[model samples]
Target: MQTEYRYITESLAINDYGSGDRELVSVNDGPGELDELFQRVGFYSASHDFRELCGFIRRFPKIGPYNALLLHIQRPGCTFVATAKEWKTDFNRTVKPGARPLVILRPFGPVNFVFDLQDTDGPDPFPEDLLEPFKIHDRSREAECRYALDRLLNAVPADGIAFYPSDFSTAAAGYIETAGIGSWQKFRGHQLKVHYNHVVSRNLPPVEMFASVLHELGHLYCGHLGTVDKRAWPDRKHITDAGIKEFEAECVSWIVCSRMGIDSESEKYLADYLDQNSRIPDISLEVILKAAGMIETRIKKGIPVPKSMKIS
Candidate 1:
């Protein structure tokens, strides 16, 4: 059965993660209020995907539901403080200056975690250059990275998980060390690297970008990266190896995009690649469909292995 989880707080006080000027207030104002507020928030609003909230709930299973409380505030300053239980009795409590309290209430269920949004800052959901992936300086195979990304993330089927879209392509079209520190996609302590170039020409279409993120998420969903040999591929026998790589990524991207009713450029790009590989019978839609079915099952059951499903 689907796990039924909810944010049982009576109200939600949210601000611009850290901006001192807290402007909006979101509460469980019932259906009508939610609808009106959503109309103002638009589709890509921060709260649109309740997956994060679900993560929050799961992380802190100790917090009671109906009995829990929500604290919403306007100015949750740098020193904004929070906790699961009473600070004075159950735990320690100390409010220092320079901090603002946005919301202060007991959660409805057992307490697992309490986050002061100020501490755990995240990326701004909307950025001007978010679509940089579509633009590339090189027209070589690197140009296909975004298209490959789209197929990998959105085309795969996975439950309760998704990949975040990123425009930071690398100069190495095959593999390179990621710069900076503490990046999320790091594998083996290295930032998740791919065989793509950092070229920019145009932003990936919004639907395509979203689909790309989902498609990459599928790679993670199926644990394809963790288990599958980085170099060994099923279609290594084909003359069009690049075509084969794109096909795998695209097949996953198409599956996730189709399942969620998202706009996918899969049909367009896949058709182009397939045309070039007309001699390869294994690169057919029937093969794609077979792979997708296997991916879908892995995502649904939360199986974290490539062996979970056999693509027959």
Candidate 2:
């Protein structure tokens, strides 16, 4: 494959993905949602937290020119200034005029999620020409989370076994592997002991047990919790984003239980959870796909999920 090249600000130190070392290329300019994102967040400065933010984003494939984009999202930023047609026509005219914008919504500060926009999928090729701007939400996502959780918990079987609440902190939710406990291998084997002690208390209703078990199952099945590194996380908490982990797990659990004829309450909780947590009114297809990965086996083959036994 021919490598695409783009120029990043000298300060950001972006990896060169393509062949050329050129500073800028407007080769595939187009009118895409990514362009709209750029118009939303405009121009970076010499010193901004964006440097760190870009550093994080650049690690992923299909992501480039993060520093420049981060610069545009920093404080004292102009919203929709850089991405407007005026700037796109001038700076990004080299690309196709009608590509769908690639949008990534990231959390910023205490209670806001910012949507970072980009045009090209792979390399920026024209990092010099790319512009970014900030768009902030003035609220918390707690409500959405509660709704999603409620929906997930309400949909499971209530008669089987006791369930315990895991003592995982919110911070640990980000980098969790959804695959499951088995994936964590040695690290989880030990950590589960500690978490088990903290969370396991009394016999829980089968449905509740199912919900909690399903939640962890979602973590494992989705490969989220399994990917955690106990030492690397802050305060021994998992390093993954909490909202993403919880929401995805909940989405998976809810849908799966729903398919298995678990109960109406599970559906109610899931509906509520979705209602309260999602920033956008609609659920994304990615969420659906992740959820599907979790519950597909149980629904298809009627596999009995794991459970804790009660002592007489």
Candidate 3:
């Protein structure tokens, strides 16, 4: 019993040990019973396989992290010799077992002893629907950003002004009408219409275009337009309100672009905006993060957005 207790304690220590210590301890006893045990429990192999298994397990929302790990390693009908409460609460299956208990770490709580696959049924959880919504095709960051941008553009509401390639003599790279008669004509309800200058679009890289579109979309989604009166659109206060609106939009663009691995001038833009007056809005960080997540999800799902038939 004392030997069993020591073994159990050492096994638990493996989880907390550094890589060197773990490897040393696993091999120090000279490749006998413990080595075989490590192999059986999946501690002997490279982490790549474990990572893949974890990725697969993460896709299933019904399974908890600990349960997922156990399901990955534990075999069917394995005996789980945990406490009665653990047996009742954690284990899905219970069977009579006469063999000695096998000490295995529980997914949660303290260390406990379990028997073998024959004594208890193990979990076999999987994604409910085989079809995953967000199937990203482009592996490169720039390509992915462009793809996401295209999807977002195509999803603009019908009432929103259609984006078109247009040659503008002015230096502006893009424009969005947030207020005034132009806004009333272009915006539908909450949707904001944006247009990119063809000269700038053609000159800039696809990633830049992605950044530009995301910045514009950030303005629309952040409720910047709704904050101002349509008649009093482009108000000086709105543009320079301690860089509130611009900072918010640029930050959104920066986050989304960064996640997609696209380099952006959003930081520079934010710096310039902040130069006007160093202050950020009281906007919720959760709101910005959630919005970025939603946008990325929409992009990955390949939500169809019709091309603008009207060319300028």
Candidate 4:
């Protein structure tokens, strides 16, 4: 019976079979029989800090096996069980005899229970501080990011790009425009003029400005600003499409900014953009990755900008 139970459980786990009417039909035995089978199959013990377990479940709501295991072991009125060591370590409380043990399967170590959680309507078990590190603050590392972006900009050809602070509205953080007006053109071939919102750049943290600059740079380097006739360029209509342009540029920004530990809305922007478009054009992932890599490399090299070409 023990061997048969193990075989059945392992089969269920591997194939993810037995759905709807077939679910738990074969395991219609009493709780004592199921408990004995679980114990035999090495599922008799588990542990976790109450808060930590709650947080883990909350963070990964779709964890199927763990959720199923919890449902299997949890009782309606009885408080949960904890190992003596776990109770001592985390709760500094004693476990009564009537509490049942919750089993957890560890990948590497001995299976053990650290703590048991009882149903409660009280405050959250995990404190805010536990999750604080995961939050992204745009200004927290602005100086480092600014230095990196400045270095990247410095590596580009001096004649090909120019930056200026403008009195644009707050909505416009920064933008890039081609330098030439007509066939005569003001600057050299395909040179770009980047404009940063002066008030926002001065008043807000530099991280937002840095991200905006990188996004515009992404458009320039990723060929979004190039003529449709250019080699490897997307179709003219797709290139001119706002959704496609924003998606590609934001994807570039996300790749580079994430690599540099800078936070941006690029992921959200890309996700929303993609969600709205049913048929996305074949944008080259390799191109985006390569562009991001080149930009990162340039920034990391820390090339010095000439004083005459410096943008204030």
Candidate 5:
């Protein structure tokens, strides 16, 4: 698809999706939502110390991300954990007779319990690699990460939402830029308003830019900024607590970023946010994952969303 717009001095009109090298294409598939496991894990991941949690994820690459997080919360500072059978088979060790077990969700069956290596009787047979924090000595994700961000931004859905770069400060990365309070999109023949336009900072890297846009979109899509169309999104502006809005948006950003293997600052930001508060905010897990799934499906391919070309 081809879109054209001239960059103005103060305001930008980014009607274009590509710069000759890349172009947008339309798709017929609908977006997806996170499953129940992710729905629960995603919430916990956001509120906790995810930077350290990510370390656990790195240390235990075999366990899934959700399981890693579960292990981190249930047992902090745990270097390695394994099932009793795995300990006996993989490391030739055995769990103590009655060592307390840590629980993790099992995808196919009931919950499972794991024993930490310290709780097991082993001869310390691990090589240096197993003892040290696993690091990629031969390669890095720099190139793939850059491409992921580009692909993410380029796959922006065309649902009356237009993204443009702005001179936003370091304190603020980006924000929603609408024509007015009730912006409308003209689709087929009908015209209706939507509050989905965005403005990201030009100074940010691909990850930061993608994250900034998602944060802003999260606010609008999650109905923190008042929903003009309840059918498209909900109307949750009644949630007067600003922390709740920020929490939900960061959760969306963290989930999507984690999916792409790009560690975003949302982990740090959300962790810090919780440190200053006494209790966790009342957030909607369903909405957060729904928003994340929508963004995820859009970035999967160059798909034109069900939107209109006319905006007013």
Candidate 6:
């Protein structure tokens, strides 16, 4: 039996996390309307992904995803940013007099003002490799693929999800099963634990291998595997339709891969399914988009060290 967790809100709100000029509005429109609205999530328009969203995300890995986006909205070319105090103490840099500070929402606190590297004058104290590890650059096509696979392998252990080697290479490349919690991850509302085993093959191209992990993560984020922490994402495990699960995951794979400039075969899989059914499967467009956004944010720079692993 799956737990009936608090799922995606039936109602959608189109407030720009403080970046939009328009006032917030509640969208009570059905799937079609909200579906259209969700795609319009770009501060400017839907086609904005061709711009700097991914680069902005990769450049500011220290801030929470929402705040990083807020920073990008306020200043698109922002480099390293630190609080006035942090700039002075950690970086030995001082904010230039009269430099207007950029604001980001402080976690559990009021707003915080942080100065970008451009606004600061300081003795360079960072090691040569300071952010080199977190940057997004490709040495070659093959290197990018290898990095994708390696990053996913290293990144999953943070969430208590372990991946093992496999021989198969298609999207059904792996299986996910509960491993029974070996330990507790950082508790949010309550003590939450995940011991998930995902198996994927290394025989495929890097892009295909990467999409396979994305496909599997699609299931976890969609609540098909059940929720370890609803605070991170809603758990809709009670949605017991196999087709819905596959459809949602496929949609997520398509959405994330498209944004990352990687082509996915999931598009063909989805198209074939739709053509055969002659109608869209009953899947939550909201959840599918949300899952893609989450995954893309994490991988936009590269595989990210989860928030849990960040401070652990």
Candidate 3: stretches off by over 4 Å: 1-140, 158-161, 169-171, 178-202, 227-242, 269-281, 302-312
lDDT of 2 by residue, 147-174 (tens): 4344433322211211235445532322
Better of 1 and 3 by lDDT: 3
Write down the worst ten-residue block by lDDT for model 5.
1-10
Q: After superposition, how far is residue 58 of candidate 3 from its true place, in Å?
A: 18
Which residue pairs of candidate 5 clash? Answer: 183-193, 184-193
lDDT of 2: 0.32
* CA lDDT of each prediction against the hidden true structure: 0.32, 0.32, 0.44, 0.45, 0.58, 0.58
For model 1, state the Cα shift of residue 268 in Å: 0.4
Q: Judging by lDDT, tell me the better candidate of 3 and 5.
A: 5
What lDDT tens digits, residue by residue, belong to model 1 across residues 231-304? 11122223244544455556556554444334466656655554554333222321233234444333333223
lDDT of 3 by residue, 185-236 (tens): 2332333433321123444567777777677666654445442322111222
Q: Between 4 and 6, whose TM-score is larger?
A: 6
TM-score, cand. 5: 0.51
Query: Candidate 6 versus the native: TM-score?
Result: 0.51
Among residues 3 or more apart in sequence or in different chains, the pairs in candidate 6 whose N, CA or C atoms overlap within 3 Å are none
